[model samples]
Target: MQFLAALLLQADGTDLTRPDLTINYIIIGVLLVVAAVLSVIVVRRRMQERDDDWE
Candidate 1:
């Protein structure tokens, strides 16, 4: 029972430490940048296609 309680407490504790948090933030930032770039490319391509349709 005590072991189970201790295990539960440990599991409930925040997993993010200083370095881990920083790395996580960096990964998220990179992903956001990639997504933004991809979206821009897709939008530009779509716009170009629309323009071509008019011609």
Candidate 2:
């Protein structure tokens, strides 16, 4: 399994020079930002609910 993985990686030449690498990075970054925003919204909403329960 390891041998086949290594063979595949070698067949691709260098890692950084791949044209699609930048697009992949951009996609990952956008996903992270969206996740963070959603997380913040959920936490804030939960906090509001908790505060209201204390009234």
Candidate 3:
């Protein structure tokens, strides 16, 4: 989490006038997005496993 936080904040110290700023935003956006995706995957897998045990 802290690593993500640092990555998220990494842009704050940089000047947006550079082209890399745009790329950084894209990377951070992707990271945040994948976090949601992975969380959903985990919950779904856990539920499926639990359901299978009930049989």
Candidate 4:
């Protein structure tokens, strides 16, 4: 994957040089996944606490 990234960076045309927009899109996607995973963890913890309170 690192080799592919370097190879892609060296390749020609607008696809490689003007990649800021593409990078932003990829960053946003990664952030969204992180947020989703964190939300799942928070919800599971809350549910567990609620169950403990009921007991």
Q: Could you give the C-alpha RMSD of every candidate to the true structure, in order shown? A: 3.6, 6.0, 12.8, 9.1
lDDT of 3 by residue, 10-36 (tens): 768674454557888899999999999
Q: Residue by residue across 1-55, what tens digits does model 4's lDDT show?
A: 9999878777745464453588888999999999999999999999999999999
Please identify model 2 stretches exceeding 4 Å from their true place: 1-19
What tens digits encode model 1's per-residue C-alpha lDDT throughout 1-55? 9999888877887763435477888999999999999999999999999999999
Comparing 2 with 3 on lDDT, the higher-scoring candidate is: 2
Q: Order the numbered candidates by lDDT, best leading.
A: 2, 1, 3, 4
Query: What's the CA error at residue 41 for candidate 3, in Å?
Result: 1.0
In candidate 1, where is summed lDDT lowest over 10 consecutive residues?
Answer: 13-22
Off by over 4 Å in 1: 4-19
Candidate 3 Cα misplacement greater than 4 A, ranges: 1-20
Question: Which window of ten consecutive residues has the lowest lDDT sum in model 2?
Answer: 14-23
State each model's CA lDDT, in order. 0.89, 0.92, 0.89, 0.88
* Alpha-carbon lDDT of model 3: 0.89
User: Which runs of model 4 end up more than 4 angstroms from their true locations?
Assistant: 1-20
Q: Rank the candidates by TM-score, best first.
A: 1, 2, 4, 3
Shift of residue 24 alpha carbon in model 4, Å: 0.2
Clash pairs detected, candidate 3: none
TM-score of 2: 0.66
